[model samples]
Target: MARTSIDYEDVYQALPGMVALLTPDLVFADVNEAYVRGTGRPRESLIGRYVFDVFPESVNAPDAKNSHHLRASLLRVLATGERDTMPLQRYDIESPEHSGDWQEHYWSPVNCPVLGPDGRIRLILHRVEEVTEFVRARGLGGDTAGRVLEAELYTRARELQELNTRLREAHAREREVALVLQKAMLPATRQMGHRRAAVRYRPAVGALNVCGDWYDLVDLVGGHRIGVSVGDVVGHGLEAAGVMGQLRSALSATSRVADGPGQALNVLGRYANVVDGAESATVVTTFIDFDRHVITYSSAGHPPPVLLHRDGRVEFLDRATDPPLDARPEPRPRPEASVAFSPGATLVLYTDGLIERRREDIDVGLRRLADSLSHHRELDPEPLADTVLRELLPPGGATDDTALVVVRL
Candidate 1:
């Protein structure tokens, strides 16, 4: 048999699938245009770099397992002279153009070894086919397959359904684990001194990601004062949840040493800036002094706490509005506002997620919350919290986590 020389590079680069040629030492020798586009990286950035260095896994979460499995598969292909096909894998990429923010990417990949003239493995061929859109389509499809071969269509459709079902199950499991973790971090219905207290936490519906919304009730000054707080970190997933946990712990520790909400929040803002990826957080902290019959509170860009008067009047503690924690390096003073509460009055502290809607302005949500509180003022603190959440979220539910703390004097 006679063989003719050809421009293999032209064919390789023209292939629709993303393809990369790597050296035996795992450095990228060449990457196709498709590969460059898929990675959102330039040829110069990838051609000389080690594969793992260019596409490192996320250490903070949501994509750590994806990085581990992909690395393992590539290593396997390098060791054994067989093609390794990986199932759909999530490999979030950090785009320099996007200020080094991580972006979601899903791929079905195969790695194979290319041989030299001596039959030694000299190069590795990495091929990746993006299946994110296809997976999403399968998840969004109706019952019918439109017009196609019934049997083959049925088989493929069933496979898509199975994949979708598996994804949903995995999401459910992840949500349950995150919820349990979040619950463990919070206090389990403890008495905040002599005040009647109740708390509610509801993660976003069908949300696989863990966000940073938390509430706490802690005793201050040997049970002479009660410290209550609600806080929300800026983003979602494990990193945000981790920050929330740290902030709660720090707040608990700081509140014990400080004299009032103003001093406590000032210290907390400095603490939040030091924690990794804790860009900003909103917090509402209140100290109820049972002996003095006064409640002093502070807001670090958090929504104001609603006060339901014993005579059915409603008011918002809209003072001491500072920027969110971690917003500034210079520690500015956080002001504390005080208001005396009657014996039957109620106080409500909540994250923005409780009242915020996707389409409407936040002020509209606030008005609705105020109205709801006015109507439900006669209810117990626990039932009042439930009523507020039900009225705001309805049966469909909200898109962000909701954390609420209610206290009755």
Candidate 2:
């Protein structure tokens, strides 16, 4: 019996497909023999050069978008750590023997990211399959029927690319409108008398930068009291965002006139029954009375808030838990609870995205949050909020929206 020694470099060079490795900055790191042969470029000359600098766009073809498409695909791979398959492109390459002469080429290109051990993108793998011969054959007049079919195919692909571009532009415009509406709906954090507070809101990564999560800090009627709340509508995107705005506004307005957190949420629950897309939404609200040194809280099927004492004790305010908004057939009074806290204690209110993870028990996430809070208990409100997010969220970011409010009492 014998074992064969394998040279990976040899395998890479011998690959049948044209392949090249690029640094995150788009500088060529290495290229396979197939790539070198396909591009008609020497290995020594191509390596370590910027991709675009070596293969500049054809100056004669002013209407061509080959470089723009390739650059955009590569940059998207870097940004999203995902593969991008570009539409068939006509890229004119300079003739090897004739200086300043360009030869028309068509290619199907794909760009993929190579991740490092720590989950960061380290390199981009650029692969291209040349379709120049097929494309040119389609234009030959002798085979009129084939020429017509191939021309139709090319036209369809180009039309599809244009349609995709327009769709992306439309999505961008919608996202902008949603973000403006969301910001207008959510209020800025107001001063909490002698207490310090920090708030953070992060939308799901791919949901057009808009989501149903929201957080609010309100100065109650009395100067010494402040109200903090975090909530999540069941869905994501523009419709959910609209529902979130209504619910958040309702809760905010109700908190001002209602007797306590319970009454405010009860009013919100009744309102959610009529609001479209607000069923099964979750929310938690806390009113801190600095004058009385007491905290009254209520929840509508939301995760419990964390109360961290100056001495490093962690407490979950779970006494007032209830079903999500509009969960019951008939309207009922929401439950409320109160807890007394000493000066210098910290109160953390958050949406479920702060703790929930795929396929993992929620208690584990809760314990992890509690441990992180206890370890970083000495930090002030702002840094503590950041630290909590850094410690709890996945490196790639959460799939759901997250809203957090940290208050130092």
Candidate 3:
């Protein structure tokens, strides 16, 4: 075969990919320079070879890829008489550039059947592609790394939610335990006849019963006089409540033995210093003895008592008493004060929580308390306490725990 003028050479050489035209027997009829370059085979060697003979591995490597699968997929399109797109496939070809780097590819084959004068199909047309980049670019862009980090963040958030749920349950149980201990600390009936005194211990805004404020009313002087003391223990929580119980009991026992309100507080202060020791600090308190309308009281370093006159006038009676109970063991050399009750009036004694504020000074808080008392003169003890609790304490909590006592003379 001298030089057969196959004009297809010019068109095939210009093509971008490996190209080939096969004879009816599937032997290479004409192929491009690209095909020779890709397979590293001479044109004469590939010419007379059958298609399968050129790439024998294609048959054995079914899913293990070869151009044969591309040929088969094209046959499928031929049977269906439609166009087809093949997913990315791979092939192993030794190339000077890549060395051992496996070359991944894709192929598109279309049949252009020749009508051999007998109206019958004859030759097939095939195209080949290299789709390495297309396969690797699933989500390929600048933010690809960000997607992985986002998944990790979502997993960590779920773990934190679970931890918070467990922590909340544990905190609720702690509050329950504290309440149980607090209720056990109430004193039994300590008054006379039909009229009795029972403590309605209100909690701080945020806490349950963990406050230092407490009260004691003990029958003394053969039921003729009642020894009443309302005091603050210093801190909050079970620690403060425990200390208050100790001090309250000591005051009740002392009041029974002392002659008057002033004498009872004087002796109680000296004992408190010894029991709690000078190292620990304590707050001021007021003790009152009710000798059938002969109302006398002694004060400490605490907020003063509020006298609500029957005429609706409020007074903060800050009479100086002995220093706070645990401040020192030395008895106050100064005398305690006394006040005869103005009949049909009321006396309100309280701890710091009632009148003390977080931002304002003690004097300012006292003024507010006295003003509030006169403002709500007609309100009963319970409602008045509620009003003051809402107003005096901040929305969340008190800087210090408080206590209050109201006696309508």
Candidate number of the best lDDT: 2
Candidate 3 lDDT over 287-310, as tens digits, reads 444445555666655566777887
Of 2 and 3, the candidate ahead on lDDT is 2
Candidate 3, residue 229: lDDT: 66
Residue lDDT tens for model 2, 109-213: 889999874799999999988877876776732234335545766887799999999999999999899879877977665556567888888877678666888
- Candidate 3 or 1, higher lDDT: 1
lDDT of 1 by residue, 1-409 (tens): 0012346678888999999988878899999999999988899999889888887766435524766777788789778888887665656677768766876566777899997635678998999987657645655221122122234446776999999999889878877887777767877766654557789887776654467888888888754788889998876766778888999999999999998999999999988888985676789899888778788999998889988898889889987778888777688889999998888899899998888765567799899998998998888878888888988875656768888888887
Candidate 1: minimum summed lDDT over ten consecutive residues — where? 140-149
Q: Could you report the Cα RMSD, in angstroms, for every candidate shown?
A: 19.8, 12.2, 30.7
Q: What lDDT, from 0 to 1, does candidate 2 have?
A: 0.86
What overall lDDT goes with each candidate model?
A: 0.80, 0.86, 0.60
Q: How far out, in Å, is residue 318 in model 3?
A: 2.0
- State TM-scores per candidate: 0.60, 0.66, 0.54
- Scored by Cα lDDT, where does model 3 land? 0.60
Question: Could you say which candidate leads in TM-score?
Answer: 2
